[model samples]
Target chain A: MPLALYTVILTQIHSSNKVVQIFGTINMSVYSSQRIALIGLGTIGISMAALHLSRESNIVDVFDTRPDFEQYIHKTLPIYMSELPSPNTDPRSSPESQPSTSLVASLVSSGRLRIHSTLESACASATIVQEQGPENVDWKQTTWTRIEAVAPSSAHFWTSTSGIAASIQQAKMQDKSRLLVVHPFNPPNIMPLLEIVPAPETSAERVEFAREYFSLPGSRHRPVVIRKEIPGFVGNRLAFALLREACYLVQEDVVDAKDLDTILMASLGPRWAGNGVFESYQYGGGEGGISSFLNKLGGTMQTIWDGQGRINVEGDERTEWKEKVIAQVNEAYGTVSAEQIQIKEARLKDIIGIQMKDYNRHGPEV
Target chain B: MPLALYTVILTQIHSSNKVVQIFGTINMSVYSSQRIALIGLGTIGISMAALHLSRESNIVDVFDTRPDFEQYIHKTLPIYMSELPSPNTDPRSSPESQPSTSLVASLVSSGRLRIHSTLESACASATIVQEQGPENVDWKQTTWTRIEAVAPSSAHFWTSTSGIAASIQQAKMQDKSRLLVVHPFNPPNIMPLLEIVPAPETSAERVEFAREYFSLPGSRHRPVVIRKEIPGFVGNRLAFALLREACYLVQEDVVDAKDLDTILMASLGPRWAGNGVFESYQYGGGEGGISSFLNKLGGTMQTIWDGQGRINVEGDERTEWKEKVIAQVNEAYGTVSAEQIQIKEARLKDIIGIQMKDYNRHGPEV
Candidate 1:
């Protein structure tokens, strides 16, 4: 289906406000309704469930092969929502904003979000199905084969695997153009980065649709499209590059892990928060701009690049480096507790929330 | 001299409030006085001068070989100060704060900050001198040779060369232990990262002094000591690593320069601003922390690392890549103007100022 036609159908459904029946048992008003199927119940799946439930308007269908799936959702959904920053608690949020608690409650009470025992029922009428079963290619392929049999022909698919290629996962699907990779940073509900990587078989309209849907106003997510289907995409590529150098510094005895973290937290972290590498370099040029910066400091940058470490974390040194790094990390941050993780997440939310507010006010033109 | 004795002498001078003669002519009351000399009046030099003059207490002496040094300072200092967020204008600043205008004027009227005709006059009774001459080894060596003969024996020095090794630059000096590399991120006053890298010959006491002095209360500079000397130190190394990948993406047609900047500004930039890489990964591990993070994702990280690009900007591809990047950057940013540069610097100051305020309120226990 053409995106324009699909959008038109959605608009018509929203405006009609007519009642619709699914499985001849559930009745829902067709007012901006979307049937979103979540095809796993792991950590990432639970976070996605909370995100969808918190919106209160989506019909979220969840499925997992485990027998304890229902119990897991019952036990974990409340905890996930509690960890999320409420508008009332967030300093950046206004008083009149909808609190996450009420939204999740509404979704549950209205039966708009529910768990299903079978994949056939979960994906029966899904307009958008998000698959996050496991990282292994075979497991994903098996799950998708089941999903492809029951999901609506026009339903768009989102694969949440971090490093798996979209092409390999969708190889057996009949409608290959509908499947694309929509990997998120961990704790997807909290962290806003959504890397969209579409395979060559995926349609351009679907990629555009994914980008727009994820970055819609009040979604609280930032979407960036990856032009090529490389492993790890952009975020991890950039992140691991930094981690590689950080490990090198520690291994080389230039600084301990604690001091390295201190250096980054105090310096690069804040600077990067405001400006990325290229922009920072442009500013560093001091009125001369990036051209002058390249002219003067390009040699220095190249020298540093040549000196950067090439340590392999999966190689022979993995055990030693891992032991050293873990020891130092544990020393710096005491035993990891649930409360400590909550505190860290809260701090991250505060930092990112304030930055988003500032970006809305004085961000670069894009 | 021992730090304890140095502190005692400074305390005595402050308590006595006796008149002291500098250069055998100028008489001033010594009350917590620090005579700081600034060499070279280029872009970095001017920012450093504004920072010192804004402090309202430091006696700053400046020198540049160029005959237009005075004119340049006169023309540039006000613009820099005006670009700085004023206490009256910044919502985060207190009402009773001294405005930057008065601070700059007071330094000039009281003869606390003066332009010197020669290096001899500039180094004459200096307690701390910041040298920001061109980033050339031979020029820096010659400049230091001239400065060593006239500077006070106990005076400390800050060599602000970004990539040059401090040992090579200070080889001609008799007291190599007093000089250390103190590289600051561009627009030194605005960006708070002060990388204190000490050479092998540098004294431990001097390194400690440098760390404490730059990070003094109200100094608005965050200092991180480098335990060992390395080219580009930490900030630039990490920065170039990110930039190298960014350029690679553009070169490989994964994304354009504009899209790459957009991706970073939206995702990695904000995340890094709040938490550095290791902490982010730790947080990403959910309940298991860094151990779980590495256990599950270490292989994926290694895969990405192996696939990373190895473009050399100083080698055969330098000209071609440089031309391509400059074109794209120019297309994205338009012609970089002075106004645009000032706007970026001001925005950076705003971001850092607010973050510092937050740190003062609810910072980590470090």
Candidate 2:
């Protein structure tokens, strides 16, 4: 047989799962040779591209609708790359002092990252297609449909929409099993969380493959599987719940936004950083554990929950409240300058680096 | 006037708040000279004593119902003191390697910390009476009454109860204005949170004094004023809200307790460690700020809020669930040994130490 014929036959076999194992574990080593198609040139898209490019040796083909999207990437990619920790550079060096010249140059020089002007070109041979378009139903639906039409039948689709459900986004697709929500927190390149929310039709084999692929040691990403699809998933749901109560406190004049932030930074922040809610309570129970803690404070917990404020953030008064809160926050934080924000992010990265180091030493525990 | 007559006149004038304030600002420098009476030598009491002794030169006279409480302090005080960041000791020293002999010796030899056999002796001249008795309302009430009987008229009372409201706890006191709940997280000596939930009768002057006293530069405690007497205050309310959702997720089997903890350690934990929920969303809004964030995701937030599971930790099913969670937690954390718990605390202290350094340099920003 001709070389092209052999390649086509093998691709068909792989896509049909005739060659891919069904009951046994899939070899994660296949990711090294896989091509990733990144659709959209927004902040998240660029961040995902930069992270994948710098952290892994996989070939990344990026697609965007804008004519000058390549120029935009060239301009913004450096900033995302700068956020990454370089092995050769001193980790403690001032962020401003150390330029990301070598890091960006290395990523470019590797010749593994490419920009495709058309979506069809980007998805032609990709094994993984990560869609990060605007979070609109129509835009996401159209984008996924186009990608699905051109991408290989075996390609796994990861939608990076923060709020949209994977099932809804992939409703029009022919094979829904390959599509899922792979939401990343802000600054996707740095923050380790990658919430993998699989659709109902998403195969267990594919979910396991993604879990292993994203959490592979070299990927530097922590992939959390969300078995059931729910609004905001886990991280944001928990965060917004905390945020709602915080807003209620401010509304009640219990504590100003600044003082409330200080309280969290000093106590709950550090506590949560080491141990999550249940484990913290478990520890809070002392030797008796979570049972003792819940038994002792269950009444107080119930009282607080019952009295928790139900402020309507989407109501007509939201604008007035936002204005008041913004003024108060500005009074406390001064103007939120880009420089100040960058400095804050740097500090956060440093703290997370310390935590990651500790986790590496002592495996993940409360 | 005679020396005795002159002293009596000075005391009366000082109690009247005439001589106490030399100028507009009350002399906070006097806190160094003011003695502290720590009533009840339980775990919290000992932890509070050790922190006060190690962090300040204030004389701490502790009293407990147990006859061998003195020996208990002699043995356990060292461990708590060792957890403190010693200015004289190396920061990188292992927890097991560094002994707190010199630290304890200095506190003892300075004539600053002493064990009192009787409550009256401990409270006779104390300017601050920190009551850390058992959580029982009767025990707290009787303890406070006894301390109030002997403590000086100008002394401030701090109740270290986690669940009981300051108002209910102080209802029987002669002067409620001076009593407030000074709740602290576990390992009080290391964790910096001091949730000051004031009673309705607590004077503004007293509140300001308590705030400054706990958060003063050298005190090494971050005090947040809970302006209203709400159940669980701020920390525990927010904590339990998050805990409820976490438990719900565990119950639903979306993720196991261990995986759920991993998700937090990676995402919400670190994010909140640097920025509280409100500020994080503010940042999440990108340059548009929090208004933008809420406007974009308000609907989704509402959905999450509505769908959030209302878990009843006090219900009968709690026991069964607690057993399952405890088993899972133990499998991950190895039965919660005291030594392991201390190590966890030490790690938290180290993380907080790094954060404190950053905050001191950058100052607190929302």
Candidate 3:
């Protein structure tokens, strides 16, 4: 039988949990491969693609308007799309700055990639298409609609958006049931949480499939149902509530920003990373515990609880804080740039992750 | 000068700095040879006295109305009061059944200890006194009045009460300046933070002295000022806010108690232990930092903010929650032993303290 015929037969058997072939090259009858496509080759997009390629899978295909296809494709994968490399700094094409093509070219030379010319050609046989384009709703809807017209009907479409509801994007897809949201935290490869929120019409089978596909052995993935689309979603909504108060305290001058962080650092924050909020109160509060504590003082807290503030994406207060922080930074350690701080923070995060892993394996006593 | 005259001159200089002089075989500073008078040897009182005697360069004088203190007191710091330890375990002294005393004795055998009798005799030129007695306001007032009559005016007084104003205790002291509320967050010696709140009339000089005294190099002593005497104090006030919601959620069946703890453990809690509610928000709310985040979401949070159900302390809600918690404990952990849990918690607290010290030095990144 032809390899294509054998592959088709194997895919059908695998879907039903049965083995159809047991030859050398096709040792596992269920080892069927699916073509995966990329929507935009921006920073987030490229990173997502790189991570997938880095998995060393024979299943990935790269598609971008950028003619620089060979730059990012893993030699084990293939890239196909309309010609002309995306302008390195185009906000609509790449969300983050494009890395030098040398990095992408190195992956391609590893000997397992193909570059293609058109969007239709890239999506013809693809089973999964991840859209990591500009965040603008209109732009996303338009781009997704065009991709939907070309991609295979069976392909699952996933959006990597932080705030937008998956259903809204899914509505633009021809096969809405296959559309879902896979909101990975920044630097997804490092942060273990991937929030899998499905739209109202999304199927359970697809959601389950997505969960299995995204979660590795050590990843901490959370499947929180939106039930209904809300402004910030669950994590952000709760997180923002805490953030609002933190910001209000700084703005009100109740506590210094660093001191506030220190207070959390000393007591609450690290604990939260280990135990959730309620358990913490259980351990921290005396006598009747958390419930009793609330009865005693919740009224006062309610009266004092300030609502969320407006988003100043421009970060006016942050700039002021930065100026003050710079002075302290200079006094403490001469001077340091934001880039240096980010680098230091990144390194610190890596150390923390290693420590956490060790802690889990050895128990906290060690 | 004559020997008596020289003694008076030497004592004056020592007392002026608030440090007592131990002129036995060796002339050691009061701190190095600490004389701690623990008044009212109730559960909390005896534990603290035993802790001080067992752990450091300290002497303990435990005073209580009970009539049989010999069995509990270490021979080194034998109890001697007009009234001895109560034969029947009073609710106030119920904690005596625990291993805390043995733990104290073990720590004491390592070489740091002493004990005494009589308020006046116990406090004779002593550096510190820990008052752990009845919680009644009038009872405390009368007890404190007696304490003022005998305690050295310069000695610092640390009262151990779950929830009471330091000012009230100070009002009965001869020298209000030396009175402070050293309220511990359960299992005092183990928990690193000792809420050091001073009374309204507490002098700045005395506050400074007390801060330094508690600072004790390796110890993590947090000095917080209560601008006004509010119920539950600062930590509890904040803790209550979270607990109220926990109860609300449980009561409303929005989530189970265990599930709630799990959610917090997985995300918010760990960060909170290190950063605190305010700092977590500052970092989590985006680059606009805290203030901007607050300005953006405070209004919305306020809208959704349901403080707590209006349950009177005597209401059925409290009893219901208690029952539910008890039933859940039996179901989940097999047996429900509050005493055992407390001991486990105390052990955990010590571990938290050690980890916290390491955390402060290296920060959450570690």
Strongest candidate by TM-score = 2
- In terms of docking quality, how is candidate 3 classified? incorrect
Deviation from native of the Cα of residue B234 in model 3, angstroms: 3.9
- Off-target runs (Cα >4 Å) in candidate 1 are A4-32, A53-57, A65-68, A71-105, A286-288, A317-320, A358-366, B4-32, B53-57, B78-105, B286-288, B317-320, B337-343, B357-366
- Taken in order, the candidates have interface RMSDs of 2.5, 2.2, 6.4
* Model 2 DockQ vs. reference: 0.48
- lDDT for model 1, on a 0 to 1 scale? 0.73
Across A264-357, the per-residue lDDT of candidate 1 in tens digits comes to: 7666776666566666666666566678888788788888888888888787864466777777776777566665555555555665655554
Error of 1 at B138 (Å): 2.0
State the displacement of the C-alpha of residue A72, model 1, in Å, after optimal TM-score superposition. 4.2
All models, RMSD in angstroms: 6.1, 6.8, 11.5
1 against 2, candidate with superior lDDT: 2
- Show model 3 residue runs off by greater than 4 Å: A1-127, A131-135, A185-190, A220-229, A247-255, A281-366, B1-33, B39-112, B115-125, B131-143, B160-162, B168-175, B186-191, B220-232, B243-260, B273-366
lDDT of 1 by residue, B1-366 (tens): 466565566567657985333223312222245788999878778777776666666788999989787766666776555544455365333423433545445556789878889999999989888899988889998888888889988788889888888898998888898889888876665777788999999998778787767665567677888888888888778778888877787877787777777667666766666566666666667567688888898899889888888887787864466667767876777665665554555455655655554322245532
Model 2 chain A is weakest, by summed lDDT over 10 consecutive residues, at: A20-29
Q: Enumerate the candidates' DockQ scores in order.
A: 0.45, 0.48, 0.16
lDDT of 2 by residue, A1-366 (tens): 332443355468777879533324322334346688999878889888877776555788888988788667777787776666664454446534644545545655776777787899999989899988888998888888888999988788898988999899987888888888889887676688899999899887677667767765566688999988888888887787787787777877888888888788778888877776667777778777777777778788777877887666666653345566766666676445776666567667766666655422355543
